[model samples]
Target chain A: MNETADTMNVPRSRAWTLFGVFAFVALIAAQVHAVLTSPADRDMGHLQKILYVHVPAAWIMSLAFLVVFVFSIRYMWRGQEKDDLLAAAAAEVGATFNGLTLVLGMIWGKPAWGAWWVWDPRVTTTLVLFMIFVGYLALRSFVDDPERRAQWSAAVGAFGAINVPIVYMSVRWWRTLHQIQSSPSTMDSAYVLGLRTNAIAFMLIMIYFIRRRYELARLRRATELIADAAALGGT
Target chain B: MNAESSLAVDAQRIARRFGARWCLRGVSLQVRPGEVVGLAGANGSGKTTFLRVLSTLLKPNAGAARVYGHDVTRAADDVRRHVGFLAHTAGLYDDLTALENLRFAAEMLGRSPEGLEASLDRVGLARVANDRVRGFSAGMQRRLALARLMLMHPRLLLLDEPYANLDAAGIDIMNAVITEVRNAGGAALLVLHELAPAAGMLDRVLTLVDGRIAAEGDGPAANAPTASAPTLASAAGAR
Candidate 1:
């Protein structure tokens, strides 16, 4: 690690690293167990196995967006720098998972739906949600002042979060090619354990990603503040 | 004692830090109404940070500041109403016309954004009132920022590098606004690297070195500050 990051003495804890390791191991274990235990689907054979990663990733992505929504609201309500930083971190992480979810969904769609993509309400809304957050990240980079960036981002974040529920409900609200949702209750007894375990693993990984990303954002902000002070001759 | 309570600014040992670096160590100062104080220092001396603390852009970490009797931290909104702070950047929207910019400020301040043409005329930007700030020259942009202060009716003006891109006429317009604020029982704090351009308009010069006031000197006339250049230069250079 660069010695300068230690200037503020904000130590990065070992717990996050340990948690990160556990999460990845658990994810791999879940994938391996699901591939072995679950028999081929009646309609789709082994192709239904994509549901393990796709469903869990989609769930985790939605959770990340919800985190963005909560933190953005907190930032606007309290005007704390931490809230803004957390919101920004979750937004970046959410955008990453959103891209992942879309890709995974397409991979499943190509084989299962026999199309690479469809104008499905669920898919379209998720794409729109992804675009809004990309624009949110772009706005953050474009604005130079920290305060302005936080304010504009908080507003955009709050508005962008409105799309999450829309994305979630798109299938039921409109007759879409995308399935409504998959859960332990609706899935077969054999697949429920895999789906539940995969969701749990995905949640753990997301927590690790968001927490580590937030730590980096805090360090980056500290560096910028220190640089401003250094430029002005303060030590 | 009553008069002291009425001072436009009263800051006591204000301290603020960024990360592990202390930008302002412990700075204390007072500015009476009808005064313009020039804050001069070399880069990194905390002159700009001091201004930021007072303007409520950044809060003090270990001390206190009050603008016109309102605590900077606890009553930041109240302090903001009395302060017209021109930060390092002009903080103007590029897409908005000069007139529209002033109108936005007015509306933000809860005014109706009417009678704004005269603000443009005051800054000699009347001809380009409808032109977007993106197309305006640096000097013109500075003038538009000044027009915003004029509209706000601030009791304390905090300006950082007010003369960087200004021409002679822009300089005069800025000084006139500062003078207007002083004459109306308000005060102004100016952070300037080069003192000569605004020297004649300042009432006192405070040289901040290493995050503290190192020297102070009186201005030219009843309220002019030209005579303080040497104090500022000597005090800043001594560091």
Candidate 2:
């Protein structure tokens, strides 16, 4: 039993570390480019630089939610417990980035929009989603048995994930306090290239973070099971 | 892997891990058509894990499990179409009435509800079919779950602790159900905590300990009191 836990524990491989390094390097290069070449936005000025991180982080929020959606649906259809865990790990990472997106959006808005926060449709709906997933994760943590936790969490994840689109579509449907989306096609070549590079960098970084987080989650679960067995007097 | 072949089940060195710990390790069991096998184990002895692996709810890390010669890992959808799994909680929606729950499962399994009433009556839940599962007693909930087995008419049945909350009469009803399945030339794996009551229904008994099959032998001793099987007691003590 002791050996079983160790065998299943995911080691942080050198390749994973290297991937992390490359992601950070790419991020720094994009940040440097955004800082050095691009002129201040006529409207937003220096606040635009925050866009490099904030937009990508926001993009990750949805991408991560999508991961939860896919895994949750698969779990429901097939009843695979691991799919539930994968969905849970993705939800945690998504919640982290979603929070970052919210805070960074505020930091940008304080100067440009003259308000620290706004009850815009996108922001409000995303906040609701963040709360829903937060509840999802909380429900998972509160449960003791693995099977029960998986079943309950998968149910919540599948139902809660429906809110992701509501967040994006909220901006389009009713009048919102948030700004309309900036047109991607209208961007200058240089600005677009910078944004694209940073987006890719952020995506790579997001992948690393989610993978590392998943491994950590897996290890933590393993260690906890060992401790539980020990508590039960298993040798 | 052809769905039409009618192979019962073949598990090859199936190992399942939970995080870093093994829930079941290098475990293998086979069941052929018309076999009623009882899986006897103490708590945490990997009985549920083994069932989950067979049901395609959890994949084994290092081996293959197939139902009807359908590889659970690769041909899971096909395997699921043939197997009906019942966990401790019945896996039924608490808010849904018995009929609704059966209807939902029927739709998901692609089984028509044309004979759902017959299934409910077979499980003795037709009288209370309109009640939400939350209002049902444990025995009632279990009966509703068994009704699911009847409605689907699956080729293989996996029951985990199906007798947990049942009274003596309920156990008889359950045994009748298992016997009916066997009579139809289907296979059933019943995970049980005690063998005395349901031992007669099984053709053989397989014991589990520490995530592996500890013993595979004849059905529980008929003349002896079934309570003496210390497997569950030992497991409880281990915990």
Docking class of 2: incorrect
**Per-residue lDDT tens digits of candidate 2, residues B1-239?**
35435658888777666755777767778888899888877778799999998988886766777788888988998898889888877778999999999999889877776777777887778898888888889888888888887776778989988788888877888888888888888999988776666757777778888778887766645214544345444532321
CAPRI-style quality class for the chain A–B interface of candidate 1:
incorrect
| lDDT of residue A159 for candidate 2 | 85
Task: Please identify model 1 stretches exceeding 4 Å from their true place.
Answer: A1-14, A167-186, A219-235, B1-5, B12-28, B40-64, B84-154, B157-185, B190-203, B208-214, B220-239
The i-RMS of candidate 1 is 8.6
TM-score chain B for all models: 0.91, 0.89
Looking at model 1, residue B11 earns an lDDT score of: 93
| lDDT per residue as tens, model 1, B1-239 | 47766888899877766655666877889998888898888888898899898989886766788888888988999998899998877789999999999999999889877789988999999999999999988778888888887788898999998887888888888888888888888899998876767757877877788787887766653123355445555433431
**How many angstroms is residue A171 displaced in model 1 relative to the true structure, after the best TM-score fit?**
7.7
